[model samples]
Target: MTRITSERHTDILNGYKSGGSRFNEWSREMLGDFTLLKWGWGALSMRWDIDDRFIMPDGVMFGGHIASVADHVAGLVAMTVLTDSKERFRTSRLETNYFRPLTAPVAMIEAKVTNASKTLIHVEADFVNGDEKLAVRINAVQVRRMTG
Candidate 1:
């Protein structure tokens, strides 16, 4: 199976224009300073600068930040399909593989729902900078609990 590249799924921009302001505001509220770069269908993307507020001694984006992006994107994907039905889930597993180091001050992360099922959803996400894939993440199971 061919993996989806970062640029293809999530495009980094100098800013947002096409309703990006609304997305930005919503994402900021949902995820603090971590801005929403873009989102569509079952896909969501974000960015966070390696500023003083979030920097490690070894350098690179914090693991928490990466995880946050994963959760945000996955939640957004769930929201996409969540209509009148009230669906809830307690994520059982979330995993990631850091492929490259981010030397850039800022890094962009994106997540996508590869498969959506009745009881479980499969998701894969990635963090990248410029043209390099920094991290790869996957959420195996999203057990949709019935809310009666």
Candidate 2:
């Protein structure tokens, strides 16, 4: 397995901060992050403020946003692992479970690559609120896009 270099990690973080990439722009526009805490090998973490757009009718965060974050972070981790610039990753499946309503002003997402193969990458992400309460659990499978 190839290891992720520090420069690549920096590029990934900068991509997110600057919204230089299409994925980064979409994620930032949808998920609102105040800080990207970590971008290590096969792992990414972020602290985000609750976007009012993500609020549900009940006045709490929508479950769909949590799922989106999990999937998006998985793709970001896959991007870090990719070697060629032409290569890309897409989510094949995503499963999310909501344990509690997230009403906090801020939340954290910790995403890690659990397993990776030539064709598929498995990832898991957890969403926790400011009080350390587990709000959502996310699992995803990312597939490497085939190219000619």
Candidate 3:
């Protein structure tokens, strides 16, 4: 279990250059102003500064934004189990449950790979608010693929 620092994350991103500009940009947007707090074997923790743009008119974070963060982080956790440079994972199914409204200025996200097989990987993510309450939970399955 190795801690993934910000520099390590940058190295990993640079090592995996398969994703084109579109994918990279999308990931960046989903993880806006995020800090990698810690990471080990198949688990990672991150903190995201919630932007005012993501807040809805009712003053709560939008559900879609939450879902996107889960999906992106889940994929990153799945990548931790990859054994080959050609291996890639894509979310095939994602289910998100909102337990409470997210009005916090920041979000703490934790993602871990629960199970994995030759072709599929299961991941779970939790989004916690500033009050340390669970705001959202996400379960996802990622399909593994090989690239030439």
Best by TM-score: 2
TM-score of structure candidate 3: 0.82
TM-scores of all models? 0.64, 0.83, 0.82
- The C-alpha stretches of model 3 lying farther than 4 A from their native spots are 1-10, 13-31
- Pull out the clashing pairs in model 1: none
Assess the local accuracy of residue 79 in candidate 1 as a C-alpha lDDT between 0 and 100: 46
- RMSD of each candidate relative to the true structure: 7.4, 2.7, 4.9
lDDT of 1 by residue, 34-62 (tens): 66566665666767554554546776666
Single out the weakest 10-residue window by summed lDDT for candidate 1: 8-17
Clashes of 1: 0
Candidate 1 ranges beyond 4 A from true positions: 1-32
Give the per-residue lDDT digits (tens) of candidate 3, residues 65-127: 888878888887887777666777789999999999887489888899998788999999999
Whole-model lDDT, model 2: 0.74
Ranking of candidates on TM-score, top first: 2, 3, 1
Provide the overall lDDT of each model, using Cα atoms, as 2-decimal numbers: 0.57, 0.74, 0.78
- Candidate 2, 1-148: lDDT as tens digits: 6765345445766677554666555666777654666677778788878877788878788777777677767777666666655566788999988998876489888888888788888988888987899888888888987555
Query: Best by lDDT, which number?
Result: 3
